[model samples]
Target: MIKNIIFDFGDIFINLDKIKFANELQKLGISQNDNTFTPILNEYEMGLISTEDFINYFKEKLQVSSHEIKKAWNCILLDFPIERLKFIKKLAKQNKHRLFLLSNTNDLHISWIQNNWGMDLYNEFKTCFEKFYLSHEIHLRKPNNNIYQFVLTENNLQANETLFIDDTEENTSAAAMLGIHTWNLIPKKEDVVDLFTKNHI
Candidate 1:
């Protein structure tokens, strides 16, 4: 009996273009093969650093302009399908279960989403969730036990009664370890709208 649902935002909702982002970064001199920025990225996602500091790090290291850095960083974000919105909206209206959105996102990407989608649509999507959790806002990132624990404890939810859906195996696996049900949804091949038929909930 699943009574709560947790969803991830990136590939699960809004599309992301990793290869395009990588190509953009390469233009700014960060090689696709490089893992040097992973720690800083994690830190930024966890709200450990400010956006200015994040941009400055790249500016100083690569001697690139802030505009270029921001452009490269934001290029990964793509469209949010209308059907998914309709699906979530209908689900929210039914009020059958508590809904949540948990994503490992940074300031720049979220800001771009707000600017691109505009506030009305953004709010429409946001208001569908009982609790909306962003990594930067929550100071927590997924695949770590504590973040999931925080959401469960804060919501007074039992792990066994919650279903977490994410596009990443690493994230879903971490949630599963805590006894929560999870769907490691494939991006293009699978869609969130098929939750009932696919997850058999």
Candidate 2:
């Protein structure tokens, strides 16, 4: 029996336009592609670099002003829907499954989100989960086997009894390899609120 449900934040519960966000980076004169960008992002997510250092590093690469770089870097955060938040909370209230949130997020993005959503919105969101795992906080980012292992070990969860939903193929694939069931949702078409009707949890 599935006793746990792990959800990804970006583009699953919240909406994001990654391509649009990346295109915005090109305005700073940076070649925002995998070969040029992913390494820097990986380092930032791993907490190996400070936000200012991250901004400065990119500013130097693209010759963009600090302010402009900040704007572009924050473009990935889109919208969080209140209805979806309530739906998740309703699932938690059922008390049939253990709920967790696992997202690959960084300090700067989270700070921006907090400023926009405020403490109350954040509190309401947290109230829906038994545990909320942020990559930077735990030093375990998704698509890495270690993170899946960490969640299982820390929560005392059975791999076969947990389901992970992520928009990112790589993250879901990693979890599936660990004997956890995974649903790789296409961000644009899939709505998390539908999970209530589906009742797969």
Best by lDDT: 1
**What TM-score do all the candidates reach, one by one?**
0.96, 0.93
lDDT of each: 0.94, 0.86
In candidate 2, which residue ranges exceed 4 Å CA deviation? Answer: 32-34
**Candidate 1 residue lDDT tens string, 104-181:** 999999999999999999999999999999999999999999999999999999999999999999999999999999
Clashing pairs in 2: none
Residue pairs in candidate 1 whose N, alpha carbon or C atoms collide under 3 angstroms: none
Candidate with the greatest TM-score versus the true structure: 1
Q: Give the TM-score of candidate 1.
A: 0.96
Judged by lDDT against the true structure, how good is candidate 1?
0.94
**lDDT, model 1, position 33:** 80
lDDT of 2 by residue, 1-201 (tens): 898999999888878879878788777766655577787788788777788889889778777788888788788788898788888978888999999999998988889888889988988888889999988888778899999999999999999999999998989899999999988888767788887566655
lDDT of 1 at 183: 94
Task: State, as a TM-score between 0 and 1, how close model 2 is to the true structure.
Answer: 0.93
